[model samples]
Target chain A: MLNWIWIGLILAALLAAGVQDLGLVQLPGADAAVAEKGSRMAAVTEAAFDSAKTAVNIVIGLIGIMAMWLGLMRLADKAGLVQLLARALKPVLRRLFPDVPDGHPALGAMVMNIAANMLGLGNAATPLGLKAMEELDKLNPRKGTATNAMCTFLAINTAGFTLIPATVLGILAAAGSKTPHAIISTTLIASGVATITAIVTAKILERLPAFRLPPHDPPTADEPGAGKEATR
Target chain B: MRELLQAVATAVSSWAVPAMIGTILVAALVRRLPVYEEFVEGAKEGFQVGLRIIPFLVAMLVAMGMFRASGAIDVLKTIASPLLGAVGFPPDLLPMAIMRPLSGSGAQGLLAEIVKTFGPDSLLGRQAATMVGCSETTFYVLAVYFGSVAITRTRHAVVVGLTAELAGFITAIWVCRMVFA
Candidate 1:
């Protein structure tokens, strides 16, 4: 229900925004501002679209590179690189995620996810997330609301390591500031606090009956809420 | 060299400084508390998780770098001006807006451009940068975080994020109008 409501709101917003943009809706106060900054804005808008297209193309290259990287990493794992990392990660992962059992496949998944985030690799982080979820599901055996550990893992990922504040600062630098690096303080402050907050929030929320997975009666494979993500 | 030094210093002070302080404090406190064990275990898993996505991060960063150097971003900001101004954002911020869903650096590059065009201390530049700072890292969060967890129920996280960006933009403009204008 909540998810549906959110989807509706998003679609409505996008539609309304589109209509307003096309002049189908006579939105209030649109004209004056546009008139005032018209020429400068027009220039910027043109630049942004072209830049956006170029940005997408460059992203395409990165995606290709990342796919190759993943393949290489997999080969390394077959050669026991993954096992070595997994063994090394065991005690530490056990310490950080006590709820997750040692030797859990998700161990590798979680580590990979975090690694990706630290490097500011959104594209690379995705496969690890999916793999981790698969591992978590196997552990679950009885599908229901995800376990406390799963919930906690998600929270940490959301609040990620945020390693390269440089990228952000670098962008600031290019944007024409005398102090482009000023955001170093801000990203650190925000990302750190947000991660902490997410951990706490997920912990508290998980305890609530609503967030908890329902009882695993008979522990059947096909349960009511198992594959119901697209809905509510 | 000085600018590079300053950039490095600022980066360390801003991001690393906070991480070090916060992580130590949190680690200590959590270690002390019994329940915090679960969180620590979760946190320790974080490093490994980070390593996995390093490839993605590197690739994305390289892409972001290319975008910045390409001179393409300038054209985008101009095209988005009219539509964005309807919402009270300056056209100089158009790329920032687009990048909100795609990449942070993409937006940051645009933010840098705004600062260059209007001057960083200028009303337009400061507000835009501040808005970027205040706003969330959207696409990165969604694709990486949510995707990893298989969270079909984003629970309006995306909406909340973009809304926060829009609100910050408005607030920055309002505050700038009062202080600088």
Candidate 2:
């Protein structure tokens, strides 16, 4: 999937640039139409370089933020807060991931990861999420293929139900808005809906014929049939 | 009712991070954990994680930047505006709605530009901000999370992510209108 999306972006960029250069399609704005033959393509060349630099800068810029958040997360973990939080959420998580056993380490990592994400701590979220993925993979009999638990977890991550939206607020504040935080409630409502949709869709798709994992020998004690949903 | 929710949301957004950090420190202190040493240890991994993602971020962003600079995004936005406008979503937010799922930095850049052009208090600016906040970078999340585990057959994860993002984007616009309009 990533292979084609990456290829398609580059291919589409070149195609669009070529078409514009050939005078087949002009940009929508008056300023764009006044540009010379090669300038449009030149911009694309410049953007590639600029974007590469931006990518590196973004990562570098995140180092401090990541360090702080990860540091705090570690402190939380050492204090047993992460475990307590995970234990509190066990019932809900057990229902969400029926395949994982009652007291798997994956559950703890997932709780911390989702908690980090909700707090808008992207720096902490990714590492914790990957940890959860690795833990979940321990149960996978089939290597290099995602389990239902992994898919459901990723669904929640990608929906991104942020509580603070700190980045957005910062951007708006920097822009000198009178009420930079006004979108907070709206964002919560929207992201809340997205999170719900993601969970529902992932759960439903897991049961679909096309998406169901192929049957394999039961590796875990609670393993129901691979393609079949476990009856509660 | 709306004003009260807005005020509470504002207060929470402002204080949540500090409160979280403070609570963590207090908790660690109470537990007699070597907070400084443990933090340093975890932060060491943070550096490596940051460096590990360089190649992936560069690859994704370069492609996205080129696509945007080639004016394909503009063309798409132009084409999408009328259809989207008929549904009451501001056309200026189309770029945000499009770039959002693909690249986080790209969407933030667009959001900054949109807010600057439209004024941060404008209805369009508010909607764009809400939209970006409402979703994650779906492709980035998929690549990093699945890539970490060396999983290739993602099955329906991509579909689920995109579907969820679409739902978020639409809901952002609707909620923004209801609240801000």
Worst 10 residues of 2 chain B by lDDT: B5-14
Question: DockQ of every model listed?
Answer: 0.08, 0.57
* A192: Cα error in model 2, Å: 1.0
Q: Summarize candidate 2's per-residue lDDT along A13-52 as a digit string, tens digits.
A: 8887778777887666724533642466787898899989
Global local distance difference test of model 1: 0.52
Model 1 clash tally, residue pairs? 53
- Tell me the RMSD of model 1 versus the true structure: 12.0
Q: Indicate the worst ten consecutive residues by lDDT in candidate 2 chain A.
A: A30-39
DockQ, 0 to 1 scale, candidate 2: 0.57
- Weakest 10 consecutive residues of candidate 1 chain B by summed lDDT: B63-72
| Candidate 1 residue-wise lDDT, B1-181, digit = tens | 7578666655654574246335434544544544234334333444444444443433333333333332334334545668777876676666575565446555665676666777776767656665565445554554444433444444334443444444444555566566556
CAPRI tier for the interface of model 2: medium
Per-model i-RMS in Å? 11.6, 3.4
Query: What TM-score against the true fold does each predicted structure earn?
Result: 0.53, 0.79
